[model samples]
Target: MLYREDKKGNRISALGFGCMRLPQDDREKCGRLIDSALKSGINYFDTAFMYSGNEELVGSLLGRYDRGSYFLASKIPPALCFTKKDFERIFRIQLKRLGTDYIDYYLIHCLSDYSAWNRLCRMGIEDWIREKIESGAIRNIGFSYHGGTADFKKLIDSFDWDFAQVQYNYMDEFNQAGREGVEYAHSKGIPLIVMEPLRGGSLTGKLPQKALERLAADNQSAASLGLRWVLDKKEILCVLSGMNTEEQLSENTAIAESAAAGCLGEDEKERIEFIKSAIRESFVIGCTGCGYCQPCPNGVAIPACFEARNNFENGKNHPVFKMNPARRQYLHSTAVLGKSPMNASLCVKCGRCEKKCPQGLKIMSLLEETAEVMEPAWFMIPIKAYRMINSGKKR
Candidate 1:
């Protein structure tokens, strides 16, 4: 498989086997996949404390092998940490879960904004991370981000990060932590790890018939085309895929070994651009986040509201949220964010935001609909319960 050298001069596989989607049902089945991946030259494995059973599955599957043979990456969930002691306790639990004494690459999970980063720092998380790195429990420190480019840059500059993972694909070049952020990280000597290369299988299986025809005309499988697109960027150190079946593992392994860097021919590039254009046309909301509609009089977090809607509609199966249960827990935990900025019911039919909107979105009507559908009683009850449970545990 192709490999890229990190800042430390260690060659990491261009394709990392993410354990969030390991084949389960039994330990033996899981081990075979892990064994096969390693035998086929996959040396990087990524899991998280929140991925249900994934840590144990990976630990059991690969623990018998020499630890030096592979690199392990996992995340520390910031939402679980209200204090420095919580960070220490969570790190210890993660190490035990992975059956490893040290993690090769450790990240602050899904950092969304500057506020979250400040919260972490206020809790002495930076000192805690430094201690872990100094103590040899963590080799490299970074964060996985799912926020705006401005916030991403703030976090990137806030700390000397070794590597950063972003949700990137052909369609999301302008979305959260897009291509600019990726390049920015690389420019700072931090390697980029790309997640959602396949857009949560939407680009592969859920493609419109016309898009499929365009790909077929080029004689490329949907998966290979999508993966090759991400690997086209020389700055991307690795692309992590949560493979679930043997066929997926085999296909991806083959692609990794043969795909050349920056090898997308003119036709391939044009086709991908066309596919991206088609995907954009399918979105109902035209929020490009120009911030024209900002300063909402009703205190509505319009951008954040749109993001949640977009995630629910377009990113339901995203690995960031789907593969890891912690994502769900974190989203639920937001209900207790010291009085949320604005709920769906707070829109109050104000037309002021509409006048400022570039896309002319009927702000009042949309908010009403969003509140009714997105904030249904069925969804809020569970989230409320989760916040209560988490709050009590902290107390």
Candidate 2:
């Protein structure tokens, strides 16, 4: 397997076994998979505090291994830290969950906005992080970002981040943090760890027949092609895949073992660009989220709403959306925030959003169209029922 040197010149494996999707229903099987991955030269293991018992699962599976032999990466959820004590409590809880004395790589999880970063700063998070690093409890500090490119750069410049993880794939070259953010972070000497390299498995199975034919002509497995495309970028330090099956794990490990740095041929590069262009053409809305259309007068999260609609249509079976039950609840609750700011239907034909949109997306018309598509009466019935049930339980 290839290795890369971090800013501190530490050698980290090119392939990190993400423990967020470890096999379940059989503890022994999980151990064997861990053993196999380690035997195959994988030394970086990643998990999070909220990955559905993943910390404990990986801890049990890999706790017996010599501590110095592997690198463990874990994160603390930023939303859970409303106070200084809360930050300490969460970090301590994470360490115990992983059965480790110190985390090799630590991160602020799901940093999606400037607000979250400000909250951390106001709560003295940097001082705390420095203490952890000084005490050797955390070897490196980073963040996993899911916000816009500008916000991402703001966070990178706001702090001396050791690394950053972003969702990247051929189809999402300009989505979320996008390629520019990756390149900017790399320029600052921050190692980039890529998540969702397969777009949560969307790029693999059930491709359009035309796309499949193009890929088949190359005699390459769709999975290998997708992984190779991401690994081709030398700026990417590690690509994390949440593998749930042994076959998937074995295939990825094999690909990682043989992967060479900057290895994409001219033909492969052209094919991937063609595939990306085709996928973009299929999108219903072309919202690049440049944030030119910001400060929505009604407080509606316009771009986010459109992005959610896009994902709902194209990524119905994507694991990240399905696994987080809270996202649906949050959407439903926020849909009733205020009269105008609440739902897409509340767009009062104000042309302000469209006027500012860099893509000239006709925001008012699309809002009405999106409401009709996603928030019909039938959809509201179940959403209302879910809210009612969940509300009573909270009470």
Candidate 3:
């Protein structure tokens, strides 16, 4: 595997394993996958407090390995953070969950606005972070962002951050944090970790006939092509891929082993552009499922709705996503992914989600579009029956 050198001379792997979506039913299998990942030289393991059982899962799986051999990373969600005591409580909880005494990397999860940063500042978060670093509890401190470019730069200039994580992809080259943020961070010598490099798997969706043939001539899959686009950049320190299976683990590891900065040639770059045009042309509603438009005031599941619709429209041919795609994902989203089952039909046209969206999506209308496409009576019947059966069974 390839490695990047930090200022401390630590060799961080270029391909980090994202633990948010580890297989739910088979802990043994997931543990084996984690073991295999470590055996394959992927030392960076990322999880978060909000990712349900992920921290515990990562801890249990990684605890068998020697602590000094790998790196552990976790995040503190901004919504639940308020005071120094709160930060202390959460960090200690994280350490316990991960079965570790110290975190190799720590981040303030999903910083969206300056107001949240100001709140942390008022609570003396900087000094608290420094204390943790001094005590050797946190080896590095940074943040993951979901705001526009201006606020992103403001936050970059606001603190003594060690690194930054953002949603970057071939499609999102001009979106949040976009190219400007990447260049700014690179100029400052901050290691920029990339998440959603596949745009939550949208970039790997079905392609146009022409685009498919073009990529196939080079023996490429949409997923690999999408990943290589991000890996092709020099500014990206690590590309986080949430692998649920052994095959994905092997494939991404191989890619990282051979990947280098600016590896895509003129034709390959043109093919990526062609693929981008193909995706945009087929898009009915543009949403990256980034969750910035979430916590809807009326309890509507905005990103989930768009995800189902987009997947229904494009993911039917993608092998990994082709299984009862839309309804199954929608059901899963409603049941487990979020706080409530606020389907697309629940929208009140409040327009709040649109303003918050970095993509400037027509959220209310798109929710209407989502309802028209994904909430048909034929699709709703079996899902409703399944939900009822499960609810009754649990009761």
User: What are the runs in model 1 whose C-alpha is more than 4 Å off?
Assistant: 283-395
Off by over 4 Å in 2: 281-395
TM-score of each: 0.74, 0.74, 0.86
lDDT for model 3, please.
0.83
Q: Can you write out model 2's per-residue Cα lDDT over 90-171, one digit (the tens) per residue?
A: 9898888889889988989878777889988999999999999999999988998877889888888999888988878887
User: Any residue pairs clashing in model 1, and if so which?
Assistant: none
Per-residue accuracy of model 1 over 207-314 as CA lDDT, tens digit each? 656688888888888888889888988889889988887899999999888766796778888888888776666554545443446667766776556545544554
User: What overall lDDT goes with each candidate model?
Assistant: 0.78, 0.77, 0.83
Q: How many residue pairs clash in each candidate?
A: 0, 0, 0
Model 1: weakest 10-residue lDDT segment is 329-338
Q: What TM-score quantifies how close candidate 3 is to the native fold?
A: 0.86
Residue 244, candidate 3: C-alpha displacement in angstroms: 0.6
TM-score-wise, the better of 1 and 3 is 3
